[model samples]
Target chain A: MVIPVRTRGTTEFQGKYPEEQFQFYFRQHWIRLFMPFARMILITAIIATMGYFLVELSFASGTGSRHIVIIMILLIFAIVQLEFLIHFYNHCLYMVVVTDRRIHRIKKTLFITDDQQSIDLWVIQDIVKSQHGIIQNTLRFGSLRVEAQESLLRLHFIPQVGKKYEELMHLREKARHWYIQHQSAHPSGSAPHPTT
Target chain B: MDLVYVILVALLIIAIEWVLWHLFVSKSKGLIFPLETDESSFRVATPIRLRLFAIAHTAFLLTLICSALLFRW
Candidate 1:
């Protein structure tokens, strides 16, 4: 995914409307990157050891094929390096954002594709948090399934799921209360659709 | 000798990194997120650890390139 680098103040995000109040956002847990990172390290170590031995053997034997063998080893090592870059880039680009009016999931890739899904807080029907396995339990990270009437937004490996879930519940209640009050005040053709 | 080839490979890696950075990172630099804060009593601090992790990963790649240079020499 596309790599983003910056930090600033405000709840503001891309595509935020003037009337919308910014809330908080979160990405998949850092723990989710552990497997790919560990795999890269393991492969790099193995390749380095083998490459060292092969380079030394070929060099000491005074063979003309030493340079080609070294180049091949370097090429293989480069592949592992590229793999690490891709994984980290993807991790940085995937995130879920919450606003007073809506909850949004943004997914962007490094090339030409990106996707965003937004669900109005008022339309949220239920939120279920799931933390399976000893690792997720001990690490305090899990998945949240936000069920709307017609759509479901499943946020996986959310860091601090428990705390965020509580905050989300509070925001949803606030949004619903605001919606009800607005509807009562308008009471006619002025009220906007809940899905809008 | 083989050192020239190693250096060429290193240059290739740096070129690839630079091109990728120019294409993706620079173009999307303005995409900023609001600071993590609390409205009432609860505040969620920005994901500083994640940013640090990203920095560390960049450092690791640079190290890999350096290591390749040293290993050949």
Candidate 2:
């Protein structure tokens, strides 16, 4: 069964044809990464309050340096905040775009920006979905492997990927058909092959 | 001694954050103009290292608060 492509809003492609383009979907890792920070905030608050009592107990027993303990707690709070910001930024680097022509994969790192790789739908031989580990199975998120001519690239940690796999396959089929038609019409001209 | 401890803690947090960013976040996968093509497609995921650091930082913050309460002049 094919999932009908719906036009949710009229922002980016109002006049350009709504059904033609859709919003890019990120892998579940993009969303799950925030879970740790959210959990940390709740956990840290509870621990900090408990630490106050623990400090009092230590002082009464005359066993611990109250000053050192207090400083350590403050440092912990700062570290948690920094971690959230870093994780947010790191998750931002992964991107996948499905255009009318092809699928584009982009990954960004610190010092240098990598070139984009586009895989024409016509060249895609197969779509493979592999899920390993308990969390992946339970969460229903895992990697979608795409096999193409020159190489194979995996789309990782896609949440509820069972549906996404079907969706991608449908899209790939559509792209392949489109390319074939375009090639027939302009037989002399060669399609722009994506650079690796 | 207190000042030195603060600096050391800050440096440690920064160092961890830097490593995670470089290793996972910033690893180049060959897409020069991804944002230009589709800004929303490229997004930052939750950083695991950063979360760990946050837990550590919370420990430090509690220490500071306690110090202020007990040893303030």
Candidate 3:
């Protein structure tokens, strides 16, 4: 049986020179979403059950306070729901994207913080990954540290770190090869210098 | 007080819906990544969870509004 080899797929992203091709991308681990989501669910359940009993008790007492209790329950529910939504949106906005030439970290929030960081892949000197604790090891998410010639890029809680690390290493080699080929072909042209 | 509650709930619904629609449905300028680049024609598919959350949030808001209105009546 002939198995096909995996190749870097072509993807396009905005805010890049026309030639830059997307190689891979990933975000923080699923734990980022799961923790907050689990907390929200727990709080919602507590509020729901307690609110149900409280409302029933208040209604039995033939008091007008039941309406107030209902309103309070609804308010708390809204707050919890909003918190979960915002958290999910914030999580979705933060991503690490690798292209043929550069690695980019895009971070944005719904209202506040917007930041993007990039480093050339060809200049990357080392890529190291560490998985601490049993949770990280079992879940297959960890941190990756990329040391470039000038800058150090640290990504925490990267999902599927093992696979991502291998892919990144492979891409780095391809990027370096591409950089060398372009530089040698156009020694005096607009090709990006390896030293710079 | 109940009138105030109704107004607040309505506002919450509107605000949540607006945020969700802007982030997911509308062309969001804040998003660094493009849905699809013009030249390459390659597109990033939105995560299924995100899409599902958007739908679920809208449905939840609709249900909340209906319940609030029914209670008020």
Q: What is the TM-score of chain A alone in each candidate?
A: 0.87, 0.68, 0.85
The candidate 3 chain B region of ten consecutive residues with least summed lDDT is B36-45
Instruction: Show the lowest summed lDDT stretch of 10 residues, model 2 chain B.
Output: B36-45
For A1-196, candidate 3 gives per-residue lDDT tens digits of 1111223334444455556765666668778888889989999899889887887777777546776777687778878887888887777777787776788887777777777888898899999999999999998889999998789999998877888888788878888987888888988776653221
Q: What is candidate 2's TM-score against the reference?
A: 0.57
Worst 10 residues of 1 chain A by lDDT: A1-10
Deviation (Å) of B65 in candidate 2: 6.6
Say which prediction, candidate 2 or candidate 3, comes out ahead on DockQ: 3
When superposed on Cα atoms, how far off is each prediction in RMSD? 6.0, 8.5, 5.6
Candidate 2 displacement at residue B57 in angstroms: 14
lDDT of 2 by residue, B1-73 (tens): 3666556655665576556645643352232222223323222212444446445654564465445544540
Report clashes for each candidate as comma-separated counts: 2, 48, 0
Question: Quick one: ranking by lDDT, best first?
Answer: 3, 1, 2
Model 1 C-alpha lDDT per residue in residues A75-191, reported as the tens digit of each score: 777788777777766666676776678888887767655778889998999999999999999988898999999999999988778888888888889889878988888867455
Query: Candidate 2 regions off by >4 Å?
Result: A1-24, A29-31, A38-50, A58-64, A109-116, A189-196, B1-73
* Candidate 1 regions with alpha-carbon error over 4 angstroms: A1-9, A188-196, B2-8, B26-73
Q: Which is the better candidate, 1 or 3, if ranked by lDDT?
A: 3
TM-score of chain B of each: 0.46, 0.42, 0.40
Question: Can you list the residue pairs that collide in candidate 3?
Answer: none
Model 2: CAPRI class: incorrect
